[model samples]
Target: MDLHEVCDLIVDCEHKTAPTQAEGYPSIRTPNIGRGYFLLDGVNRVSEETYRSWTRRAEPKPGDLIMAREAPVGNVAMVPAGLRPCLGQRTLLIRPMRSKVFPRYLAYLLIGDQIQNIIHAMTNGVTVPHLNMKDVRSLPLPPLPPLPTQRKIAAILSAYDDLIENNLRRIKILEEMAQNLYREWFVKFRFPGWEKARFVDSPLGKIPEEWEVTTINKVTSYINRGVTPKYDASASSLVVNQKCIRDRKLNLSLARQHKSRVMDDKYVVFGDILINSTGVGTLGRVAQVYEDLNDVTVDTHVSIVRPSNGDGIDFLGLALIDLEPHFESLGAGATGQTELRRDRIGETEIVLPPVKMRKQFSEKVTSLRKLVLNLAARNETLRRTRDLLLPKLISGEVDVSELDIAIPEEAA
Candidate 1:
């Protein structure tokens, strides 16, 4: 069946960008559209008036699927309850016909590999792939089973998603806990025995007398940008690029394989901090390695900042992570030519606590970061399991009719 037949409404977004403001309804752009859920963090907001004007054609509601039509072309995410999001550029709103197809089921099916490949194949553009509205409307879908079966399948997928979402929330909380700890101890000078500690004027500001202000180069054993990689699909070594570092987290899934062998020092390790070292928008983004990586290195656009010692491994990463905004300000050159130079990064100032305090901070922060890594690994496993099951369930190759599955209300 054609996508249009299963959907009651398929509306295109405003051709131009919406005017964004400090607050109002969120504008759901292509970047905010994840595989099956909206990635709302840092999403643009518009004034209520602009929201009304932009959504005049069709306002996105809960259960509606928003699919990217360009600049990625096929990524889709469903609007959840409580979000009043308006469509942004190169996005289309999909309203599935509830009686014919389950909304969540259709969303999962569209993001399935089969439909995603079909979407990419139908795209048109020399540099950036895009989908024409006509092609999108006429996109073929696999034969759907009965509505009950569709709900059952969606419920099974949703279970995985629900767990993943829960872990995501916990990860966010854990990250905040670590950040708050850093701010309290380092920034706010509220560390243990801080009240009775002597203060002195320093380059960064007044600090505990025992603490010292030091440059990144003085503390790190190595600080350098990676080499330009020769990409190869068959290669065993994965190279991290600017895209792999975001929101203080390293997503290795975005890393690509490199054809050539890298030097021993070039390989990323468990405590190393990876910073996006090139491009205007992405420059200065930082992420620390939480798990042991094998055959993984970084590209020229990323810099590896390895701590000098293991005693305060988390301290240096957390400090660098906190300096993300400052690093962004340090980008050199104009617009697209901007780069985070190795020298500038090395010269960046950071406050160093006493060895005892450093180790204490490491002990606390490492525990929280370890939890984040574990949760992330669990999410990876859930995603893999769900992805493996997605196509079969969508294509009806794996029967759900015989199984007694309790479908949730959201799936209904």
Candidate 2:
């Protein structure tokens, strides 16, 4: 069956103009649509009046599938219940014929390898690839099973996604808790026994009298960027790039395979801090390695920062994050692409609290970080399991009708 036949409506957003940030209703764009999920943050907005005007014919509702039509073609995500977002440019809205096809089932099918390959083949453009609505409507779709079987398949797939989502929520909470603690101890100067603590003027403004303002180079033993190796799809080691660092967290999904053999020192380890040292919007972003990320190397655009005393990894990461604006300001460029020199970053000053206090802070956040790591690891496993199962289930290669798996309340 053609995709257009199964869908009640297939429409892209009429408003092709970029929306201003933080000023109006949430505008769903290509960036906001992940593979089978929506990224809640970082989406731009348009005025409510604009949204109402633009969405009169293509109003997005819960259960509708949103797909990227350009930039990165074919990536899809389902609109969650209660979200009344207006679509942004280069995004397509897909409303499934509920009587003929389950929305979640259609969404899963769209993400399967078969449909994605079709999308890739149909996409057009050399510089900025895009899909034509005419081609998108005529794309082939596999024969869907009966409604009950479709529901079963969706239920099975959604279980893994639900657990992953739950873990992500927990990870966010843990991160916020750690950040708040950092703010309390360092930013607000509200550490224990602070009533009697004295203050001293420092280059970074007034800090605790006992604290020392030190350059970044003083506390780091090793600092260097990795080389851009020739890429090999079958390589063992993954190469981390600037995109790997997002929202102060390391997203390994963006990392690609290392092309050639590299030195042991080039490999990332636990306690190492990574900085995106080049590019316009990506420069100065920092992320810390919490575990010995196995067989991973960073690209030239990313600089690795290791502490001198082999301690204070947590403190250094948080401090760098707090001072990100300063580093960003140091970025120099003639063209739009900015670059942060190693020397400038090395000379950047940061408040150094007492060694005991820094150690205490690290120890305090150990459990929270451990939880985050475990949850992240679990999500990775869940993602792998889902990927393996998705194509088979959606293509009817594996029969799930006979299997009696209870649908979780969340899926219900």
Best by lDDT: 1
TM-score of each candidate structure, all chains considered together: 0.97, 0.94
**Across residues 307-402, which tens digit of lDDT does each residue of candidate 2 receive?**
877558888888887777787788898756789888898998878899899899988988998899899999999999999999999888899878
Candidate 1 versus truth, CA RMSD in Å, comes to 1.3
The residue-by-residue lDDT of candidate 1 on 110-135, one tens digit each, is: 99999998887776444789888899
Per-prediction CA RMSD (Å)? 1.3, 2.1
Local distance difference test scores for all models: 0.90, 0.86
- Give stretches of model 1 more than 4 Å off: none
